[model samples]
Target: MPSAQDIASKLAYITGQLTAGGTNAQMKAWYDEYKKLNVELKEAKAMQKKNPKDPNDLQDPKDLNDPKDPKAT
Candidate 1:
């Protein structure tokens, strides 16, 4: 699976090609690749958000500072 950045770069290139115009078949191929890369980029971003690299970046679901938390006292 390509990283989000890689997918984004490919999508940008495809967009440029699409805007530049081409034969029907060529345009269709580029459009298809663009769509595929867009989907991959979304998925990669979602995965990246779901699994951050740094453990410290994750937040506890139940705040220890909440008054309701027994340890809050």
Candidate 2:
């Protein structure tokens, strides 16, 4: 189970790679992990509805298409 920080880090890295024109293989690998983690995070959140300190609660939902993100720059 990835913590919010871990997810954030992965997302930032993937966004950076995309912005930098990563190779297709690298992009595919990152995308696979990202999708898997996202599903896990959603499930975890649903199961732990009462936790104010839930991991996913710490970060805003990532917008992969957002150009304002630092990694996108």
- Which candidate wins on lDDT? 1
Q: How well does candidate 2 match the true structure, expressed as C-alpha RMSD? A: 11.8
What are the Cα lDDT values of the candidates?
A: 0.81, 0.66
Where in model 2 is the C-alpha error above 4 Å? 44-49, 53-73
What lDDT, from 0 to 1, does candidate 1 have? Answer: 0.81
Model 2 TM-score on a 0 to 1 scale: 0.48
Report the C-alpha displacement of residue 32, candidate 2, in angstroms.
Answer: 1.2
Q: After superposition, how far is residue 57 of candidate 1 from its true place, in Å?
A: 14
**Local accuracy of candidate 1 as per-residue lDDT tens digits, 1-73:** 6667778898999999999999999999999999988889999889878886633333455433677768778
Which candidate's TM-score is highest?
1
Model 2 lDDT tens row, 1-73? 6665566577677667767777799888877877776776676656556675554454445533367766775
